[model samples]
Target: MISHMRRLLSLSTAMVMASTAIAAAEPSAELIAAAKAEGTLTTIALPHDWCGYGGVIEGFKAKYGLTINELNPDAGSGDEIEAIKANKDNKGDQAPDVIDVGLSFGPSAKADGLIQPYKVSTWDSIPDTAKDAEGYWYGDYYGVMAFEVNKDLVKESPKDWADLLKPEFANMVALAGDPRTANQAISGVFAAGLSGAGGDVAKSGEAGLAFFKELNAKGNFVPVIGKSAPLAQGTTPIILRWDYNALSDRDTLAGNPPVDVVIPETGVVAGVYVQAISAYAPHPNAAKLWMEYLYSDEGQLGWLKGYCHPIRFNDLAKNGKIPQDLLDKLPPAAAYEKAVFPTLEQQEAYKEVITKGWDTVVGANVQ
Candidate 1:
C-alpha cells in the first residue's frame, strides 16, 4: 500500500509540473490586442558588438510588418539615459518605445520614473531574479566577466582570480575601465569581490578597494577606456572582459595570436543588458509587440546565434535549440546555472562603493 501511494504521488507531482509549464507558456491576449493597434516601435540601445539587436529589429519588422522607426545606438548607457530625460514630456512624438541599458543603470532609470511597467506576455519565461516585481525592466542577455589572456604573452593562462595577482602578470593586466564609468569594468570588480577579495559595500568596501590598490601598486593595472579591440590585439596581454566579447574577438582573430577566455575558478560576475519601455513612449503598440517577440523562442534563438545566452532558459532547454557545437564554446552552462543576479539593493550599495573607490584606486592616476 505504501509503495503504491508513493508512486501515485510522484506521478501527480510530474503532472502538476507539466501543467504549470503549459500555463506559463501561454501568451497574454490583452498584450496581443494592444500590439495590433500600435503600428511601429522605436528603441534606444547602448552600443555593443555582441547584443544582436540588429537581428532582433529586422526579425520583428519582417514578422509584424511594422516599421522600427528608429534604432539609436548611443556610445554608452549615460548617453542613452540623457536622450530619454531630454524628451520625457513628449510621450507620443519624441519619447522612445523601448530602451536597452546596462544592469547598473536599470535601477536608476526606475527610480527616476523614466521606465513604464508592462509585463510581456512571456513574463513567466524570464527568470524571476532578472526582472522587477512591478515589471519596470527585464534582462534579455547576460555576459559573465572572465579572463581573456593572450596565449603568446603567457604560455600558461590564468585560471582563477588568484592567478591574476601573480608577480609575473605585473604591469600586464588591463581592466575595461573604472566601474563608475563603465559597466563592464564594474562587473569585473563585482566578480573580484565575489571571489573573496571583499565586495560588501554595506559592511566594508575595504576588500574591493584593497584589491585594486594592490594591483595598482604592483603596476599590473592598465587603464583603457572606450576601445577594447586595440587592447586585445596585443598592446595588453591579459584583459578582464565579458566572455562574449572575448570569444567574438577570438573568433575574429583565428589566425592571429589567439585569445583564451577562462571563467575564474573562484567565481564570475555576470552583467545583464536589460530592456524597458519608456514611460512616455510615442509608439507604445509597436513597443509592446517588439517586447513580446523578443521574449519568444525565435528571438531567443537569434541571441544564441550571436553567442549570447537566452533569457528564456526553460525554452532553450526544452527545444534543445542551443547548438551542441556552440554549447562547447561556452563555459559549462552549469557555471552560470546558479549565477548571481544583481539586486536593487546590491546596485544601490555598490554605486557609492564603486564611485568613491574608483577615484581613490583607479582614476587618481589614469593615463
Candidate 2:
C-alpha cells in the first residue's frame, strides 16, 4: 500500500522541493526498438486507480503501442515479489516483468536477488535519498494517510484521529487494508499513535496498537476491509486510506453518495512507493522502457492527476513543468505542510511492531 520516504518541504523534502534543475535522458533508439520487439510488458500489483496508474498504463500503451500484461491488480507488495520468484524460470503470460512496491520492499527485494537494476532516463530528477545508489529501486510517488468518509452517510467527518473514537462512529470506522499486511493500514495505525505520542515516531507503533485496541473496545472499529465499494455502499462509512486513494474515490463516486477526504490535523505521515524491474524479467527491455516512461514528465503528471505526489515533484514544480490545473487539483498545500516522514529505518521498525502485534494488541481481524 505504499512506497514511502522523504520529509516535506511542503511537497516532500525541503532540498528536493527547492531544486530547479531538470535532467532527462532519452531512451536509446535501440532500446525502444528492442522493447517494441518484445511486444508486451508484464506488471503486477498495480491497481488502475491507485496513484493514477489507470491513466499511466493507458498512456504507456497508447504511446509505445505495446501490450501491458497486467497481473493481480489486487495483489500486495509481497505477492508481487512472489510472482517474480515463482516465475523465475517461466517465460509465459503469467510472468511479471516489473513491480511497484513499498519502499521497504525495494531493499529487501534487492537483497533477496528478486529484482534487476535499471536507471530510468529521468533518474537524476529523483531525490538521492529516495532511490537506491545501485539503481536497484527508486521512489515513484507518495501520499499521506487520510480519512475517506462517505458524506451521504456521515454528517460530520472526523477532524483528527481522536475524533474517530466518538460514540457516534461505532461500527462505522474501518481500515483500508489488513494492518497485519497492508502498508497503508500499518501507516494508519502509526499515524494514529503519532498524535497521541506527541509526534514520537519511535512510540507510534505501540501507541497505535493501544489506540486501535481502545477503538475496538469502544465498538467504534469495524473489522472489515474498507474499499471504495464498501464505503460507497455504507458498509464502512469511514475508511482509512492513502490520500490518493481517498481522492480518487471521491472523483469516482461523483457525488452520487458524496465523499469527503480529510487530512487529520495531527499525525500526518507520508509513505513512498518504489519501482523496480524483476530479476527474472522475460521482457527486460520492455521493463526498462516502462521505467523510462514512468519517470518521464508525462508519466509523473499522470500520477499527479490521480493525486499522488510524484517522487520528482520538486523538480517538476520548480521548473514550472507542472500544470497549474494539476496543482490546483491537489488538497491544499497547507494540509501537507506538517506531514512527518518516517525514515525507512523507522518504517521498518514500526512495521515490525504493528504487523506482529496487530492481532494480539488490537484483536480485530480485518478481512
Candidate 3:
C-alpha cells in the first residue's frame, strides 16, 4: 500500500509538470483571447496611404474587432521614437503599442531599450539580414530612392544624380526632409554617392556628401520639404524621395500636373523600414498579435499593394502564394535584387557621418 501511494504521488507530480510545460509552450490562443479583451491598440506615424496602412489597419480592425488609434499620420521616424520614450510611463491609450521606423532607428531603439523582443510565428520566414536574431525589430518593407518631378513645370526630368547638378535644375531640387533626421534624405545622399563614386558607395564615404555640397553651391538644392503640395505647385520641381512616395504621388495627382517618378540610372539604393513593439506597450498581447499579422501572408501582400516590397516576398514567391497580376504591378524585381542594404552597424556609422557632417558638408536646406 505504501509503494502504491508513492507511485500515485509521483504520477500526479509528473502530470502537473507536463501540464505546466504545455501551457507555457502554447500561448497563442490565450494571447488572442487576452488581446481581444484589450480591444484597443494605439499606434504612431502610420499614414493610411503610405505603405497601405490605410487598408492594413482597416483590415486588422475588422478582423480582430479592435479599435486602432492612429496618431500623427505625417510624423517621421524620429517622431515615432519620441512618442515611445515620452509615453513609457503612460499605461493608457495614449501610449504607442508599436512602431515602424527606418532600419537605422531599429538598432538605436533596441539599444535604448525602447523596444522589446518578440518573434512571431512567421519569424523564420524573414531573412536573417532583415531582422534582429532575438527579434527586437524586423524589416517590414523597403523602397528605393527615386526622383519625383512635375513634368508640366520642368520640361526636362533628371535621369541621374549627375543630371541634377546640371544648370537646368537650379533652385528646383529638394529632399523630402533633412538628412539629419530623415532616412529618405540620407538614402538620397547615399544613392548620389554611389552614382558619383562609380557604383561603389561606402556607408561613411564622402563622395555622396561632396555631391550634395556641390548641389548646394550651385543653388540647385532648395531648402523646402518635398511633398505633394510642393510638387504640384512646382515650388520644388524635383523632389528626391522614396519610390513609393513618388509613385503614390503620380496616382494621387493623376490629372493635375502629372508627376514623373524616375529611378536614377546609377546608384540605386534601397531603404528598409522596421517594425517593433514598444518596450512599455499597454497591450502587449495585442502588440504581439499585430506583429504576427504584419508578418503573415495577408499583411505582406497588403504592403505589396501599397507599392513597397515586403520583407518576405521571396518566401511568398517560393510558395506560389503571390498572385501574378499583383506581381506584375511591382517595380522590376531585378532593380531591388541588385540593391544594397547596409548592415545595422554600417547604417549606424553612416547615419553618424551624415548627421554630423550635414551642416558642415551640405548646408543646403529645403523649405
Question: Which predicted model would earn the best TM-score?
Answer: 2
**All candidates: TM-score:** 0.78, 0.93, 0.88
Clashes of 2: 6
> Candidate 1: where is the Cα deviation over 4 Å?
1-40, 46-48, 65-74, 90-96, 198-205, 226-228, 319-326, 334-339, 364-367
Tens-digit lDDT string for candidate 1 (185-236): 6667667766655334343334555676777777777665423465556667
Cα lDDT, model 1, residue 21: 49
Sort by TM-score, best first: what order? 2, 3, 1
Q: In model 3, where do residues sit more than 4 Å from their true spots?
A: 1-27, 203-205, 365-367
Question: Deviation in angstroms for 116 in model 1?
Answer: 0.7
| Candidate 3, residue 213: how far the Cα is off, in Å | 1.9
Best by lDDT: 2
Q: Residues 1-367, candidate 3, lDDT per residue (tens digit)?
A: 2222122122232222222122223327887898999988888888776877888998888878888877887777887898899999998767999999999999889999999999877776666767899999998888889899999988988988899999889989998877877777877887788788887646334778888899989989898878888889988999999888888788788859988888888787778899999999998888988887888788889998888877766656655667877767766655454455666676777677777788888876544
Q: What is the lDDT of candidate 1?
A: 0.66
Cα shift from native, residue 136, model 3 (Å): 0.7
Error of 2 at 344 (Å): 0.9
N/CA/C clash count, model 1: 1
Q: Give the alpha-carbon lDDT of every model.
A: 0.66, 0.87, 0.79
